[model samples]
Target: MAVIENVHERVLSAPAPAVGRLIDRLGSDGDPLWPSPTWVPMRFDRPLGAGAVGGHGPVRYRVTAYEPGRRVEFTFDPKIGLRGTHTFELLERGPESCLLRHRLVATPVGAMRLLWPALIRSCHDTVLEHLLDNAERVVTGTVSRPVRYPLRARLAVAVESVRLRAVPVPEQAALLHAALPRPDLADAFSVRVPPGVSADPQAWADGIFRNPPPVVAALLRLRNALVTPLGIERGDSSAFDTVARTDREVLLGVDAAHLDFRADVLVEPDEDGTTVTLSTHATVRSRAGRAYLAVVRLFHPPVVKAMLRRAARVAVAPPGPGARPEVAVAHG
Candidate 1:
């Protein structure tokens, strides 16, 4: 074999997900991304266009360096022999449009070059050209001059599945606010209200409007993560725009199926000490196919009730995995 081959970068105009799927397929056993490329057609019915529904075959590869809607890079299997890594980056061009960059690097340092020199480069070039052409058509809405049956059918299917809904800014803001995940799902906390703190719930609600802004921010982040996907802790949420942190609270659209929450806490002096009243608003939906809205109606009250109880402990006392005086359910 030889040392390392060259790195090639191809830029195509297409939706991010579409290009991404193609890259995933190319690097995997299959060819270009997605289950089908109805948006773009191959110049010829070659390897990139030919493959069964599943992965390519015995060839195996480890995918890594994935940054969704941004960059995804993966490495080919070395044990089976030849190895390479291809990365795809999706850059927004305009509304409902994006540019995709595909880079493939092949290394013959092992025994791949001598064993399959011509085979590797040919395969690599074929993939690059195919991806570029498909992307252009998908972006410009121009498929190969003469439309084919399968390609036409795929487009028809996609068209049938597409649906649109208009969301007002206020509604969008409310949705974003409610969908933020919850805290207890992240870590344990400890809360210690003064021993004589009144069990009165009214006092607790009043205290919140007077407490501080940071308290609410911290609470929102913690709860949002736990109620979100697993491992989606508050820390994870802060790393990026999973949920935007705006200068002034604004409603930015979040993918459906995502969850966000808002809470109001108030407290009043009770004979015992004080009482806390906590209220939460929740929003959730699913993300799939043409970004259509998924109507999700379920028993959300109980799930929220459990989370409020957990948050109460964190706010009143130091955070830990411990219980305090009984939290009488004045009204759960």
Candidate 2:
């Protein structure tokens, strides 16, 4: 096996003490610093210190060394193909400045050997950049240069992105009213109920809206994770407060706080099936908003697509064997 190391550094405007507090907060439960939405939120079993086990998602590690207001190191257990130590250090630069550095030294074996160079490395780079930006923001009150997803990442987002699903309009308008996913959230909702379930659109819509589809809930979690860091407001029912719902279509608007723009989701029946299209038509009011939107646009489609697929699974699924007739829901 060969050694792999990545080092990222940033000069913060604040003193070492303030910067250190931010670093120490990483991995602790409820830590204010949120990583990029693409990565799992950092978590730990106990306080952030020596011997405390922590990592993001399935990546587990133990704090091997700790120095309050100075440095900390995490040594990850070997799993699949990764074994390494990641260290963070604060170096006082001046009376009101400090240099924060993160270093990852690891050896990748087995499948990880190829995976590291192929995928993890790129994502790690982006995450590290985001981590640095977040650290500086706590003390500087702004991130002058936000990180953007690389082209490779953007391409991946495009490849797996979900599009509209073709759900046949129920024979009765009431069927559509009932089967539709909740429109309260500024997200795309699609579902096809089994024949046994009430086909009335109103009934389906009422029940669906009462308890958001699992996929929509999961999507909201990711949405919150991404927008909270940027200080953007997440969409709620107010997104549709101004829209009009008709027997054939539902028109709603969505706003992204701090970004100074609005998006709309158009739910209408096409000749083939119902089509839900999410479109943003507002001019970005600020430079910062434009930059932020540019970065997030790549992620938006994939999120919508995933929700559609999930909705398809839930809406068309049989309650029991031969409980009801299955309907064909195709992705458009």
**Highest-TM-score candidate:** 2
Query: lDDT for every model?
Result: 0.38, 0.57
lDDT tens digits, residue span 1-332, model 1? 54454544444545566655554444332233421222112121222222212122233445456564467655665765656765566776665566666665656555565545545454444434444555555455543432222433333323322211221223223323354543211111112232233343333332333232464446555655545453332323322222332322322222323444344333333322233333343343324211211221222233333444433432322111122112322222
Question: Each candidate: how many clashes?
Answer: 43, 14
Q: Per-residue alpha-carbon lDDT of model 2 for 211-269, expressed as tens digits?
A: 45576677667877876666667666565343445554333344454443333334444
Best by lDDT: 2
Candidate 2 regions with alpha-carbon error over 4 angstroms = 154-332
Q: Residue 292 in candidate 2 has what lDDT?
A: 62
Model 2 quality (TM-score): 0.51
Error of 1 at 289 (Å): 59
> Measured by C-alpha RMSD in angstroms, how accurate is candidate 2?
19.3
**TM-score for candidate 1, residues paired by index:** 0.31
Q: What is the TM-score of each candidate against the true structure?
A: 0.31, 0.51
